[model samples]
Target: MRWARAIHHLEALAQECAVMATRPASIFPVRVVELWAVGDVLGPLRDIDAVTVALAVDLPVEEVPWLGQPRGAQQWANATRLDRNPIVGLWRSVHAPVWNHRVERPALVWDAENGVAEKTLAALHDGAGERVRLPAPGAEEWRARLTEELAVSVRALRDCTAAYEQRRWSPGKLEPVADALWRASEGYLDVLDALHGPPEPT
Candidate 1:
């Protein structure tokens, strides 16, 4: 898959973030976990976006063998289960205001994130594919890399959204791509706020 490398990179980042969550002095433990969750969600999302782009450009659909299969449901289920994880639940309970402040439209964003994954996986049943083990970076390096990669993923999803819009695809087809873009953009914003702290109050 063209996005294989990016997906792997995200996984590596997520792993590092998980370790960061364990640090005694980490002030952004919840945010770190959120980043990890976002990375998990993005794996399948990137695959969906890639296939959507391929289809838009008139590429052979056969290259993706998982489309129109049931396996995607399982993949989506597995990826999203983390949202209900106890740690994430605790974050929601304890840090609701902080998260809301950092991410505008938190409910809508979360819905879009899950909705896109469900719809895309239902239609295009490809799992996250093979794992590419990457070495987790140190704190400073991982933070820098996460910012860079989040930007790249957001830009790619934006391009994918444009491809669908340009072709005048149906809402059914276009909605998922747009939702994916929205989710990715929110994830980027969340990360930025986590890294540098949220913007000062007006």
Candidate 2:
């Protein structure tokens, strides 16, 4: 399944990040690498959820399953015109969050990331100092545990995909597998959160 493949890619990225973190290097560089690694995995993680949702909804396999439709020229022009309007622009700038809330946002893989890359970056920075102070497990052990958990999550996703393909009309058929996948993914994210503390206040 595409979702399973994405998770596998995430596992690989996590392993790479863990190894880099363990290397004898300055803390700043190590943290930088970790932030970059998080950025790298974000794509695959998004893909995993996107594909899973597409499959769950029985979207045609031949069709590209985008979570949100691309804006057309007219839509872009309207947005540009609105931004050019000084009065509207001023109001939007003052109430950016409220204005943004009205926009359609994709259902991102990690809701904690808030579909904002800056939040993820802030998360890394917020945790970097504390992570250095925390006593972490051995690098090899950490990698092994994450790899194992990811493997199980991948397998669950694969099984769910197969079940969907075979008997899609069967109600609740994919629930167990989907639940397992969700739990496993959450566990993986929890491990990372532990390693790097929570995101800083906006």
lDDT values, one for every candidate: 0.34, 0.30
Residues 88-191 of candidate 1: C-alpha lDDT, one tens digit per residue: 21122212121222222121111212222233222222333223212344677656654654454456446646765775655446665555456555655665
* lDDT (10s digit) by residue, model 2, range 1-202: 2534534433333343344334443321212121122122223223322211100111221111111111131232242242232211111111111111111121212211222233433333333322222234466755564454344335544554575566556666676445444544454354445444656889
Q: Give the 10-residue window scoring lowest on summed lDDT in candidate 2.
A: 87-96
Model number with the top lDDT? 1
The C-alpha stretches of model 2 lying farther than 4 A from their native spots are: 1-136, 171-202
What residue pairs clash in candidate 1, if any at all?
none
